[model samples]
Target: MADNNNTLRTGDVVMYKNQYRATVSEVNADAGTVKITFDTGGASTVPVSDVKKA
Candidate 1:
């Protein structure tokens, strides 16, 4: 919904809220959420609006 994540997909690296660098591991367009793995090894589901292709 008007986010840079429109082109996002698995394997794409993104910046979380303009900070943490994370990799997109899964996308849930229907839920408007994305599963991301941080370079630090932690993972979480974030709203699509929280990330953008880096």
Candidate 2:
């Protein structure tokens, strides 16, 4: 995460590829990575640059 102050918590919905909605499960600002559990039941680690708050 470029901005650590802008923290996202679990259950926060975000937009990913294909307009899919995912919840923030974990965040690693140092690595600019966030672990998201998608509405489709899939979890993945995505770079902060690839996501946007929904």
Candidate 3:
């Protein structure tokens, strides 16, 4: 689950789905989602519950 104090922001580094580390590109706080770009060159929008600071 997404931590209340772990509010994400653009340019922050984070782990996605406990699978890969990725850079946060955008945050939709109202929607409870974030768009991230992986180090391997891919991007995706995921729920805040699936991400955490790296």
By summed lDDT, the worst window of 10 consecutive residues in model 1 runs over: 1-10
Encode model 1's per-residue lDDT on 5-53: one tens digit a residue: 3578999999999999999999988898999999988999999889988
Model 1: residues with Cα > 4 Å off, grouped in runs: 1-5
Worst 10 residues of 2 by lDDT: 1-10
Using lDDT, rank the candidates from best to worst. Answer: 3, 1, 2
RMSD of each: 2.3, 2.3, 2.4
lDDT of 2 by residue, 1-38 (tens): 34464567666788877488898898887887889999
| Number of backbone-clashing residue pairs for each candidate, in the order shown | 0, 1, 0
Which residue segments of model 2 deviate by more than 4 Å?
1-6
The per-residue C-alpha lDDT of model 2 at residue 51 equals 69
Question: Candidate 3: how many backbone clashes?
Answer: 0
